[model samples]
Target chain A: MNDTRLIRVVDDDPELRRSLGWMLGGAGLAAELYTSAEQFLERDDLHRSGCVLVDVRMPHMDGLELQRRIRRRGSQLPVVVMSGHADVPTAVHAMEEGALSFLEKPFTKDELLGVLGRALQRADELVQREAAHRADLARIADLTPRELEVMRLVVGGELTKRIAQQLGISERTVDKHRERILAKTGAESWAGLTLLAARLELVSGQPVEALATA
Target chain B: MSTGRDQRQTEPGSVERTPAFPSDAFDHLVSQIDDVFWLYDCQRERVDYVSPAYDRVWGRSAARLLADPLDGLNNAVVAEHREEVRRAFLAGLESGRFEAKYRIRLPDGSERWIHDRGFPIRDPQGRVVHFAGVARDFTERKLTQDRLRESEAFLRATLDALPAHIAIVDPQGVILAVNRSWRQFAECNGLAAPDHAVGLNYLKVCDDAVGPDAAVAREVARGMRGVLDGSQSELMVSYPCDSPDERRWFELRVARFETNRCPLLVAIHLDVTARRRAEEQAVRQQAELAHVARVATIGEMAAGIAHELNQPLSAIANYAEGCLDRVGDDRRPRSDLVDALVHIRNLAQSSGAIIRRLRSAARKSEPRRSSICLNAAVRETVELVRYELETDGVVLEMQLADHLPVVQGDAVQIQQVLLNLLLNAQSAVRHREQPRLTIATRSGKNDVRVSVVDNGPGFGAVAPDRMFESFYSSKPDGLGLGLAISRSIVEAHGGSIWAERVDGCSFFHFTVPYSRPDIASGPPPGVSETGRRLGPAQHKEATA
Candidate 1:
């Protein structure tokens, strides 16, 4: 799994880039090298499941800037910022910008490997979560509009009669829609259906209240 | 005997009688005159006649003088004047004229200066028979003449004592008198006139001057004429007059004065070469101090420099580590291991180069002149400050022109100038939202200009030229010597430096000539044609 995962190394120094590639390759991992952050950002597969190791001080776009750009593009790829010196403020800034880790230069082979391993592991977990969320989103997409309304109200902790009244429908019809939601989402029970609805709300990036109002 | 002589002298138609008046009448006139009339009988060796005024003039009785004429004359003569008197008497007797001015002591211990004149009376056979003359007291007139001569000697001595070459000129600019110093200077400079060019028209000389000093001489002439014509009371001019072996400066001062209502000019030329040299030395010492201060400022950038050094070192370590890892694995290709090793070597070399550049800059040495490429210098200097700018999030842009010509200057000093400008720009934009600094180079007609521009609060209240003044600081802790030193360094290399505000940016621009106008063509001493130190191989090649 680690070998399949790509570790993108972005730095302005050519020797550092080449050495990083070799080191990662020797450690039984796949590595890609880029001379600058801009070059890395130009890739169409930026949203792919992988981790990026970027120097904190690159020409034009820095490591923190690259992290922000990735996040803005809705990519959950983990970033590890490398600094030539042990600058606390820059490290803190990188962390605040959602970097997975900060590495000072002259780091030992073990240190680099350790940081990259953790970043890749985090990248894997993020990829898995994204997949699960997409699966939930697709599953939630299948239900009828009435079924979704009933599910949102159910997840909102509203009783069946209140939900039926809010929807201007009979309680028996609301019960029938809930049953369909559970069937479509593959939930074995009412609790399972509610959990599925929560997952859908988390993935769809919409608050449960908004969904209920809708 | 005296009665008989008087009776003969008074006889009508006497041989010694006056043609128009009687002998007795001349005797009466001589007795009444204040001068003493006497007659000396050379043949008889005796005094023949003496007027009554002799008693009052010589303070001796006539009878006493007649008794011993030699005793009377010798006794009254002062000891110092006796020999001169005697010598004059004997020589005059032989030469048929006796004239002596000598001091005589009276019997009362008073002194008198006497003027005596005598004529030879010849007999019919042309043999001298007697001598007659008048003696007068003229002591007061002699004293006045003596004082006047003493005063003239004192004035001449004073003029010669002064070191400044001085000359007194008339209203028409004719040099009347020149002091000893002036004469000596004229002689040294090969002026042929023995009187130190006196009687020469000074204004014409100035107007006719040739060579490099001609213009300055003409200016001096104008100033002097102003003083002479009463347009100005005095005029002073300082100018360079270099000799073949050494450089020199002189100051000329001209003032008008009157002596006996005659207008005159006193022109003084003072050698101020020492003062000029001292001033130049002070400026040079300040430059040296500024250099030392610049090295100290570099110390303040230690963190950034270390960061720059760390990059290559870290790369070396990474390469070495990778090479070691691969060497232990039998499956690793030999070519791959060799590649890593080569990279490690190259990284180490680059790190060494960085340290070398730093040491070269920090070392305190005499500034060297050479042809240096501005682009290369800019690139090298940027290496030292890149880390700091990056850490501060400053946006640095370099727009160096392609094929920019090399300039003549000290590489380290030029770098220092660029470093100062860069650091100042960085500090100016440190607090801004987007700190942007741009360093650009351009080639002009005869020089290359470099500019460091910063997007920050422009020089609001401070004048652009005032910013380059020494000790003029806007920062709280700044010594304010950076731009000042930069200006001096650039100027010393025959260039110019200035600062200005344009479009909300503080721009510092300096230019260095492609070849220094003062320096001759070819490489400076101790440097090769390639702008490198003359090593043994290069020296041999150069000689060959």
Candidate 2:
């Protein structure tokens, strides 16, 4: 269990939530508990990367509804649905809604931990990706207006002379701006800068569209 | 009514003719004809001519007929009718002709009715006048009319004695007659009494009816027309008529009545409000009974529902099993052990909470009626029995209809019956191979039905009806009140319950009437003489 990972348990049954939280905590996993899906959805801690263990059948907002709201908010937090009763259709629907796992009641210790492990692992991966993406976005944001224009043309496969002509700037100035972009973005070569520009979605106009289709 | 007075507008000149015969011949003619012919002279101020037939009309001889005045007719008039006759007679004297009817006592100790008439003739100078008159014996006709009227009144009284409203309508939908009950009902409802409603087209009256049942009244109007025209011979429609103050129900029936002149429609409207209320009250009472049963059944299976809840509780226990091992083996952090301890503590608290919730919910249950989904009820009942079924090695299947109409019921009572059936199914299949129980629900035209079928030993020799008797039970521990009370609950909802065998399996089925605004079904059978709603007896007639 990673201390960095937080597992949230949401259920209408106070006992089930507390017990699940306890079991996860005992497994060395830091856990947050919510008595209902709405409580979990309203928490400021939603920004933290975590896995949610939600009961499928609840009073107003159910596990599936919570999952939908999380997804619609673009949180990308993984969910593992559990039901006290044997409701297969609801489980399948929960899975279809991008739940990490669907577990029936009386699941073994291995099964609960295994589901939590996988869900938390995915959440961690998404968090890491988001962190890297955020850094890339900042690097792209740091680019000057002229440097961004130079990077776009470069990724478009245009010659440096052609970029200078399109921008009505001297070829030497275009070359200088390209160097600055490469430095700021940590690209080791011309091809690396082009890849980074595409990776960060910094390419604009024709080249970005071309790269999307490609 | 017809007056039968033929001389109200007769010509005075025609009535002033001389007697058809001379004095002796006229006396013989009047005596022979059963009528009195007489002549009066104004100048004498007394009766100058009289027929011997006065004995038949006035019950007195001709000489005594005028012994008091021009005639003793005024003295012979019935006491109550004396002034009326006197006024008409005095008016007749000035109008040249008159006709009046009155009752008189005859000389033979019999009463006779007479219609007297007189005509006046003017002299050539149009100053002096002569008068002649006839007294006809109308006793026989009057007696017959009186008997007819008495019999009609007796028939009306008979109809009024019934608790139902009755009316006789003509072919044109005109209300020719109505019983006392109809008038009372109309007055109670702030409507016109029969006297005012008669001769008013019944169809129009129904069309003009106001209330929630106005549509039903309109339908009745249509049905009445059908009955009047011979298009339909009989019609009966039951509907609800809720007033601003209270709820009411009635069955409107239209049937043909063959009159001597022509066929008519007989409408009978019965107030079934009490019966309807009794039925609802019975359902509520049954719900209370069921609530008790549910608590009792929960007592019987407290271990089972607890077992179901324990599934998750046990999982927490299982997951915490490794915490001790990992903490001692130095393979897991101390935090893991703490989390396990916390989880165990939480599971303990939760188990208590679940028990508390279930116990209070079961113990404090009161009859709560509402529109409920059968699927939800099935699910709750299944939850209550699932663990027991598992322990009994039985597999359960649910076949629930989708988008089934919601029916008004006491959900707790319905669940009790379901739980009872499922438990019975489990027991029935306890020894069978691959024991399976299927619970299904479906919507019928006017009701919702639930069926529990099991691949189990059938009712070996006991008749189905025998199973519902109090204290009748095939199971060693069953009190037999389950099925009896179940049947009562179902019937109290205006539905029928039944049990049968299919493919060597036992099937128990019941239906509950669903409330719909458009059309309502007749009340369930076994109504008492008072027409008060009664509990289901036999439930022998199955509507499936």
Candidate 3:
């Protein structure tokens, strides 16, 4: 079997926990068990590669709260909330609070395996995105302050002269700064530079420069 | 005698007049020497003196009157006064100088009122003297009497006009006087004539009306005296008078008058018979209504009572069945097993009897004439609704009187009365905050009364008397039939039933004639007089 990914089980019922562990193990995935959200919080290993299957009801802390706590801890743990009695309203709430999926209890072994597998796949994609985002931020960090400012103005579609006036510099100086920003950001054109910034979450609002900042 | 004007005339005319020596002249003027210088005699013992006044009064010669016989002189007087004049003359003759007043007959036989003065003549020197008197007539004085006649007529008219039966009786209660109206009243009521009543003792009429009872007669006499004495202003008493067959009230008022020396009694009568009859009728109706109320309450509880009886029956059946089953086991000796089986059979018989009672109560179709087995009847009634018992999750218990005498009535009616009671009880406790139905039958002196009690919300503060009326039910969909029919049945069987809340449980009880019937063979063998065969109380315990 490929030891490519892991599935974490969070439940208080020992029987449910064991069942899911065996079920997840049989499905070509490694499984980690946490008796409660509090226990999982105290774990030495973060298990960044797996999807956490959290039971919705427990004696103390419940699944939805656990999901929020995991995200707060910066675990990026993809949570799949499983409820014994799944009602639409509650499932909708779980999904709203960033649950990868909601599975009702007494589910078939296959249903659990299928949902867990999908959850793990989604987690892998998210992990890859996080890694890319980190690399992107590092590369964006190497730009000089003036080069960064030139990059914003160039993506905004301002001509060299306008850029020089806006920045209080010569047009030639503005053109020189924009060329280095493009080289560092690896943007072949102004639109390409905006697209990269969007992919990296570099701005808060919608398409400010891309739609014509000038 | 002269008038004042005459005196003045005489005084003025007396100038130089001889005056005629008036005193001597007046005497001399009336004395006449030739008027009869002789004495006059007439008839036997009759004599007359020659007086100028007599001559004037008689207008006859004195000697001629004296020559008439004394007998003729008496005859000559008015027929009405002859004897009276003779008697007065004789009285005067017996005494000296006799004087007399008489009515005299004149020569023409005309009557005259005369005053005569006479004296007896003496022989010489104050010897006996013949009577001589001057007589004067007073006819004009007698003619002036007129007012006295009118007054006598007015008094008679006033007494005749009174309206009441006014009678003036003597102190002895005799009727001395009665008005016209009193006479008419006496005639109408078959009394004697008013005149006949005058001297009759009033007690004669009272004795006739009140009969001859000495006590009644004495009371009547006392009442009469009380009226006469003024101590009692009026005597009022009721006696059979106009209404001879019934007592009639009479108010007699008697007043005493000094003039008649009698008490006047006035009687007024009135009748009050109808009012008395009406009062008696109202009292009778109240008593009947009270009796019906008592009977109705017992009747309505019949169903609950049946359920109550059913509990014990079911218990007996179970207990007996257990004994029967155990009796066949080899572990027990044959005789012991037979005894147990017999005992079980006896219990079944007692329960059967109970069921029969219940059937009577439940069906209530026909009245059975016999002493009722109340406990058994209650049990049987409970058996009839065994399905209800199980479904309601209610357990019934019975504490029946052991030696209940058979009450006198129809057993079936008693049972139905009880059945209605039991059904009501079961319904009452259905959703009870705590559900239970208890039936108890005890021997009352003349009856075997039973009750069905429930631990549920009680009658909710309704008066028990109103509770048994028809259409009075607490259940939501209840038609209020059970109690009404139960009441009717109980009344029909001459028994009673009622409902009451005790310790939060509804109790319904009724009694039939409690004496047991002939067992065809005395309670099927093993049953004892105390109903020992019915066994001890046993109930199937359940959470419900």
DockQ values, each candidate:
0.38, 0.07, 0.01
Q: What does TM-score give for chain A of every model?
A: 0.88, 0.88, 0.85
> For residues B170-279, could you state the per-residue lDDT of candidate 2 as single tens digits?
88778787787877765655555335366667776565655443555566777778877878777777665545577566667778979699998887878778876786
> Which should have the higher TM-score, number 2 or number 3?
2
Ranking by DockQ: 1, 2, 3
Tens-digit lDDT track of model 1 for B295-349: 8779878877877787778777777777776788887679998888888888888
- Candidates in order have lDDT scores of 0.77, 0.71, 0.57
**Taking the tens digit of each residue's C-alpha lDDT, what string does model 3 give over B1-544?**
1234322323221322436557456436546432222232322344443444445555565555566635334544566766776677667666643444566676776766665555444444544434444455665554433345556566546655654455566676655666665556555444544352555556444433322233333455566677677776555432222233453222234455565533465432223234333533443343244334334533544444443444334334333444444554676567744544454466567557655644433342222355556767777667665546554667777777787665655555555566567777777777754466778877776666777787877777797766777878787766565576666556544456676667756666665543333221122111112210000000000000
Ranking by lDDT: 1, 2, 3
Q: Which stretches of candidate 3 lie over 4 Å from their true place?
A: A1-4, A44-47, A74-76, A201-214, B1-544
Per-candidate interface C-alpha RMSD? 2.3, 7.4, 24.4
Q: Which candidate gets the maximum lDDT versus the true structure?
A: 1
Candidate 2 residue-wise lDDT at A34: 90
Task: Give per-residue lDDT, candidate 1, residue A60.
Answer: 75
Clashing pairs in 1: none
